[model samples]
Target: MLTETRRVARIVLLDPDDRVLLLNGFEPRNPATTWWFTPGGGLEGEESREEAALRELAEETGITDVALGPVLWTRVCSFPFDGRRWDQDEWYFLARTTQTATDQRGLTELERRSVAGLRWWTSAELSATRETVYPTRLAELVRTLLDEGPPHVPLVLAPEIV
Candidate 1:
């Protein structure tokens, strides 16, 4: 399969209670297998990663009144979805919002097909879930972020294949 390289911006969106919001989704080819991930997507046009982060948050989760924060991590990954091979460079940023309700009004048709829905999860929940999560050890990373705050520099995470 031909691989498409994409630059993606992801957010670790948290609520006042320190719970992180995750998107539940599965590859179109394999709906029986689903995974949870943060809210974000590929950059469009000339928009920077920051702009993409904010836009994706609203589009994917419908929470716009957010305080977008620093880039917490960066990762490179290869995954197959929607019948295409993708090589993605992802940046994970920190963001906060009080509104937990999500509106799918902004999701693209493709998104609607592949993305199941959004749910806010506490660190403990993240830790307990047997489902797959991207960026690996997400619960541990989130725990570190919450306990010690964002790193002085964005950490480069090991590549992932999904």
Candidate 2:
């Protein structure tokens, strides 16, 4: 089968303490190589990036009251998951909230099997930890955005490993 390129919208959910929430999951075929990523999934037909981001944030984390901010960054990533090669173009949005509780009832079957858990990470923790995170320079990007606010234009990020 031909590998299709998927368009995804993700959210960087920040708390009052400046920590960002991330979901931990692994490639189903290779569970040992786990990674953490922001909450998101592929966009549905005709849905705008922001709409997808909002839906995904609610579905993935069950936090729906936060105001979505502008696109902070974008990246193109290719990875293997569920026995398929996925080429995904992802847009990242910034959102802030004080809510800490999350409900995982909306997670898909794949997510339920592959996702290990979630955590809130400070910039320092993101920088110091060896665990893999997508967009590679998440700590630097988060610190910059927290310090200066969102940019006038969304920043382009480098591709990350599979």
Candidate 3:
């Protein structure tokens, strides 16, 4: 028997002043409170992780010509969604963009409706905002990357459900 594979490639795009681009995402099928995360999505067909990252950035944020580099971090986890357990291996790459995104046409009506707001914020801002989840860690990561450049960190995975 063969098991299915689920791979997600995402980019953490940091601007010159050092603000990582994060998007508020939600599962429309089984609605939940919106949560903020880096902007990228799962790979489709035979698309490489790098290609998926670039494609997702352009599709979701209307930005192109991004310079993507090595994997910054990787996480393997599982989530319960749509009445099933979805195992996921998420890869994050170091990416940069000099231009500001203008058009957000890639979002669906429901996604647009669900997105409460959008703001480019610094690490301090991220820490201060009550709306941000995992505030402490997120702020620290942003600050680390901003100060010392990207760290090719690999998250350790324990064999257990998340």
Best by TM-score: 1
List the candidate numbers ranked by TM-score, top first: 1, 2, 3
Model 2, residue 52: displacement in angstroms?
0.8
| lDDT per residue as tens, model 2, 1-162 | 777889999999999898999999897778897989899999998999999998988888898889888899999998778887889999999999989888888888889889888999998999898988877788889889888999999998988647
lDDT of 1 by residue, 1-162 (tens): 566779999999999999999998988878998889999999999999999999999998889999989999999999878887789999999998889888978999888888898888999999999899887779999999999999999999999886
Write model 3 residue lDDT over 37-118, tens digit each, in one string. Answer: 7777779899999998988887778878678877877776566544567676778788887866535787656557555444
CA lDDT of each prediction against the hidden true structure: 0.91, 0.89, 0.69
- Using lDDT as the measure, the top candidate is 1
How does model 1 score by TM-score? 0.96
- Estimate the TM-score of every prediction: 0.96, 0.94, 0.78
Instruction: Quote the lDDT for 1 in model 3.
Output: 44
Q: What local lDDT score does residue 118 receive in model 3, on the 0 to 100 scale?
A: 44
Cα RMSD for candidate 2?
1.3
Off by over 4 Å in 1: 1-4
